[model samples]
Target chain A: MNILVLVKQVPDSEALVQVKGEGSGVEVEDRYTLNFFDSLAVEEALQIKEQTGAGTVTVLSLGGQKAIEALRTAIAMGAAEAVLLEDPAFENGDEYATAKALAAAAKGMEWDMILCGKEAFDDSSGIVGPLLAEFLGIPLVTTVVKLDFISEEQAVVVEREIEGGKEVIKAPLPVLLSAQKGLNEPRVASVMGVMKAMQTEIKKLDLAAVGLSQSEVGKAGSKEEILRYHRPPERPPVTMIQGEATEVVRQVVALLKDEAKIL
Target chain B: MAGDVWVFAEYQAGKIRKTSLEVLSKGRELAEQLGSGLGVLLLGSGVDGLAQELTAYADTVYYGDNPLLEKYNNDVYYQIIAALAEKEKPHILLAGATFLARDLFPRLAGRLKTGIAVDCLSLEMGDDGSLIARRPLFGGKVLADVVCREGRPQIALVRPNTFSLPDVQSPAQGKVLPLDVTVDTSQVKLEVLDVTRMAKERLDLTEAEIIVTGGRGMKGAENFQLLDDLADVLGATVGATRGVVDNGWRTHDDQVGKSGKTVSPKLYFAVGLSGAIHHVMGMNTSKVVVAINKDPQAPIFQYADYGVLGDLFEIVPLLTETLKKEI
Candidate 1:
């Protein structure tokens, strides 16, 4: 089996986001890292590679120069190789265009299994996995939290923390799966792995190589556009409660009844 | 062939949740504004007996009975809803942004190639009979006004606990429409192997009237037991901040933040969480919020409706005991 994992570099969850230029789109300030969820995807791919021990794990990412670092991180996590679909042209693609570009790259690779995080943290659209599956004409099982190889061609699965409970699915191989966090505890980068990751080769593909042009990438490539962005008003000041527990409960109840009016 | 607006009345354990009814009430108002009829689409394994409960708010109710759909699956429910949408051609579709709706509705939207405004805190009717929806973006940091510009049958996922469930008890007088939906069970490869809910005894966090969340101040994993006790006494769900989940004190499912679930309970008790903007974004919709922490300068205080300055360990247990006695 040839497994391909799609990874995206995003602002760290802890990093503060600023909407630059008085608009809806946001840019990370200070520092950024790989999306929290993608790390778990890379980890899941590595585990499958380890258990299978025969298939090759190739990391595929679509971004600019920053994506090389993300691909290197994936290599350090145990991917056999890394491919970066980067060009100035591919910047700022919407979910549809991004999924199209990714599907093209994935199709060329002839991967048996493709894995991605449920969504990109920055955009938070959560549409790419299923969208790419649509483009690729493959079955998709999203929000996947657990997976076991049922056969060489099929896998039994359970989905992530859904509303009421988990959904157990049996998906055939050569299908698309969007992973969720806790799918696997990501393995830490070993010193040897990190050193090798720095030396690993990153194959870069431009928009033209991926059968696209400048018009097919970035904002121009997007079907939906953000209209505006505004910070919500700050909540009102809180009333502090002091003294003994009994007195506090009395105050809380009275406050809930009188002030908030929920009681 | 024509209807006003439709709310998918989702029932669990044979009782309708407030979230669904809130959608129904909202749908009624929207339908009235459109000068059309309000309706509901009900489908489950054995939910025929509960169709009467749904008719209280809708002018008509459509129930599609399928044993395969008794358990929710993307394929089964979507086929049923998509078939209904194609036949009914309602001007609007609304469902609570509960887990069921979020999972099933989006796929249905994709199948029908329609736009969906998710997690909307409010929905309004425009003068032209279009639905104007207000939904949270960037994980509740900002609210956005959205409209489905493409045309009829705009869908919106109503945020849970944002609106009141009406108490009007008119008999279920609505007409019933049956849909013919074929279930291709083979495509639905997913199954519910086992089901476990954290707050099984207490109210679900998404449906809870009162939610008390803990953070790093709970001290350790064991310390959350206190918050659990408080939630038990209050019949509430125990929520936690990203910090608590990151610290390995609890599962990510229990975390309430931009990365976690967005909940708007009536009363929120925040214990120990410093209230980062991300965490506050999730619970800020709560009608009443109470914070407890030793640090007076914690950011959570800014959004908290009430604050208590002290160690949560000492205060929570006492509060739990006091509330227990009172109840």
Candidate 2:
């Protein structure tokens, strides 16, 4: 089994985002990390390789050279190799264009299974995994919570979560699955692993090299555009209560009826 | 550009979801702001009467009566809505950020080659004649304002409960524009084999009027029974913070946080959870936020309308009993 895991470098969850100018979108000054969810994908792929002991795990990413950190993180987590579709040109690609680029990269790989975070932290569209699967003309399952090997060549069974409940679906190999949080608990890289990861080779691919153009990858390729960006209005000071539970409830109900008027 | 603002009035079973009305209300406001007509796109089998209800808030109502659209399919609904938007170039497109909307909007935007802002918490008109949309990023840790600069007739999926539904209903005298949309069923590849509803009564957390949620301080999964008891008595749904969900005590659907569902219940009761921004984003829209936590330093009180400094284990049970007795 040759499992491919896709990861993206995102602004760290703790980093503050600022919107500048009248319509400029969010801008983060400093600090970024591997998407918290994609880290889980990397962990899951490494676990699959370790447990099976037969498959090679490849970590793929689309971002700048700085995104090599994301690939290295996956490598330190035990991925056999790393592929970075890194280029300044790939910047600002919307979900559709990003998925297309990823699909193009996958077209050249000898992948039997693909796993990715359900969505990138920056975009949060959650459409790329399925969209790339569509572009690749393969079966797609998203929000996968659990996975089990049914057979080597025939199929794999996984739980796909939806709104209310989850569906356990068995699909043939070479399928694409997007993982959600809690699919697996990711382990921290050891000193030795980190040292080894520094030496791992990262294959870089640009737009034209990936069978695409500048117009096909970035803001130009996106169907949607960010017209304007701004900060949310500061919320009013909270109307706090200083009394017993019963008294507080009464005050809350009053405020809701009179001030908030939602009830 | 010539058409009115269109609200996707989503109805499941017979009754319309509250989010649908909220969208209509927001769309009506936007249409008025833009000096355009208000229109609603209603799709479902046996939904002709629902058209009247939608028309109560809209100037025009377009009904697409098809059984295939009764239960939403991403491809089917996307095709229908995309075709409608093409024919009727509405200035602004608004829909609830429900599961149906999440599935259809991005795909439809891709198919139409338009831009969309998803899960917007607030929508307002910009000074420059563009629609400014506020959405959360970094798991609701930060609220990012976004706008579609280039797309014709900007598209957005409004988060549930962010906007209030207007009490004043318009006269149900709008024109019913029944659309004759061709359905290519073969294009819909995914089949819904079955829908197993989660076990519970009342409403889901996202759709609930009142939500009573507990966190890890509640102790164990079994302790959630008290929260459920309170929810039952108040005609509310039970929700949990990420702490509880991560403990494998409850399903992720029950989680109230940035990664989980964003709920805007009328009244939200937070028990034992220290308010993380992620958790607060889910319920911050509630008209009344009452928090019960032993630690005064818990961040929940900062956002909470009412706070109780006591053991939630004791307070929740007492409150539940007292409310049950009073009501």
Candidate 3:
């Protein structure tokens, strides 16, 4: 079994996002890391490969030159190899075009299953995995928490998180599953693994190599164009309450009833 | 067979979810703005009766009743919705940014080769007959104003609690139209083995109106009972900071921060948690924020509407007791 783990690199969760150029763009500090959820995907893919003993986990990502760091991190963890889809044309694409490019690249690879985070921390659209499945005409199960492979049946059963609880689903191989929270406790890379990953060569693919033209992969291929970005407005000043616990409680309850009127 | 504004209603547990109604209400507003008809699509088994709740808001309620839809099959729902959308060519389509919608609408848009914005905070009509949707990206720190620069049936999945439910109309003038859809068994590959929703009364954080959240300051798993007690009294759902969740004091479902669920509730309580930017990004849209922390310098106090600088162990029980007496 060959598993493809789709990953993304994003600003550190603790990093402050700054909007620049009159909303033309936003900039974050240099701090960067693999998206928290995508790490779960990496962990799940690695666990599957280790337990199955007959499969390979190759991490794939689309981004600028920095995204290679995320792939290397995945390799440092346990992936056998990594591929970086980096090209000027692939930048600024929305979910539709993103899946289009990924599907284009995926067509050339042999895989039994594709895994990715349910949503990336930056966009939080949760669209690519399902869109990729649609582009490939395969089934997709999202927010997956548990997965088991039925090798003999050539199918898999997955437990997916739903609105209220969970659903156990059965689908054929070559399906796509998006990792959700509680999927697994991701493993940290060891010193030896990190050293090995530092020397590994990563394969890079551009629009032409993937057989996608300039129009269908990036900003030109995107459906929705971001008009602008505005920093969220700050909330009003807080009304501080001090004194004894009883008095503070009284003030809060009264405030909720009269001023805030939310209670 | 036609409507300019279409809302895909989500029905679960025998009732239409509140987010669907909220989106319907917004759809009604958009429909009025365009002076066009509003239609709602309801697809599920035994959901025909739920159309009555939607009829007040939509001019027409289009329903496709089938057993295959009893539990949401992503493929079946997509098949049914995509075919109808192709035939009718709706100008705008809206659905709640839900577990179902987040998964379904993107695929729907992909198949239709159109544009969709998910987890939007607001939606408006653009000058070009397009939908202008404001969404928070990079978590809640940034708000983006975007539009589907080209396509028809511009799709958007709006976050719940962003809009209010419209008042039900007396003598409902809306009509119900049943759809003729056949279940294509060949396309259905995913099958459900079992479903477990442990507690019916416990609400999902996204849909909860009031939330009482704990953080690392809660100390340990045993202390979350204080929050549970307070939550029990106020009928509010409990949430946690990622730190507490990672510390094993709470489940990921109870986590409300970046990397967890983004919640927009009416009233939010930040208890024993020094607000981190990552945590605040998730619940920043809350209408009323109340912070309780012994430390006066906690950053959470900045974003809070009401701040009580005191020990949560003492303040929480007293607040609950006081609230109970006052009510």
TM-scores for candidates 1 onward, in order: 0.87, 0.85, 0.97
Q: Could you report the Cα RMSD, in angstroms, for every candidate shown?
A: 3.4, 3.8, 1.4
- Which DockQ-derived CAPRI band holds candidate 3? medium
User: In terms of lDDT, which candidate is strongest?
Assistant: 3
Give me the candidate number with maximum TM-score: 3
Candidate 2: true contacts recovered, fraction: 0.32
* lDDT value, residue A3 of candidate 2: 92
- Model 1 Cα shift for residue A261 (angstroms): 1.7
Q: lDDT per residue, candidate 3, B1-327, as tens digits?
A: 454899999876788888998998899889988888999999988877888767877888999987777888887899999998999988899999988888788889988889999999999887766789999988877889989976668999999899998777777879999889776879888887787776758678998999999988989999989888888888889999999999988878778987788899999999999999889989999999999999998999999999999999999999888877777
TM match of model 2 to true structure: 0.85
Which pairs of residues collide in model 1?
A168-B191, A169-B190, B45-B70
Q: Where is model 3 chain B poorest over a 10-residue stretch in terms of lDDT?
A: B194-203
Off by over 4 Å in 1: A19-27, A66-69, A83-94, A191-225, A244-246, B1-4, B125-132, B150-153, B166-169, B191-199, B220-225, B242-252, B276-278, B321-327
Higher-ranked by DockQ: 1 or 2: 2
Taking the tens digit of each residue's C-alpha lDDT, what string does model 1 give over A73-153?
888878879998877767766555677688778777867788888766665556676667756756666667887865555
Per-residue CA lDDT of model 2 for A214-238, tens digit only, reads: 8878777775555555565455666
Which lDDT tens digits does candidate 1 get at residues B204-320? 678788998998888899988998898888788888888888888888777787667778898999999888877886788888889988898998888887998887877888888
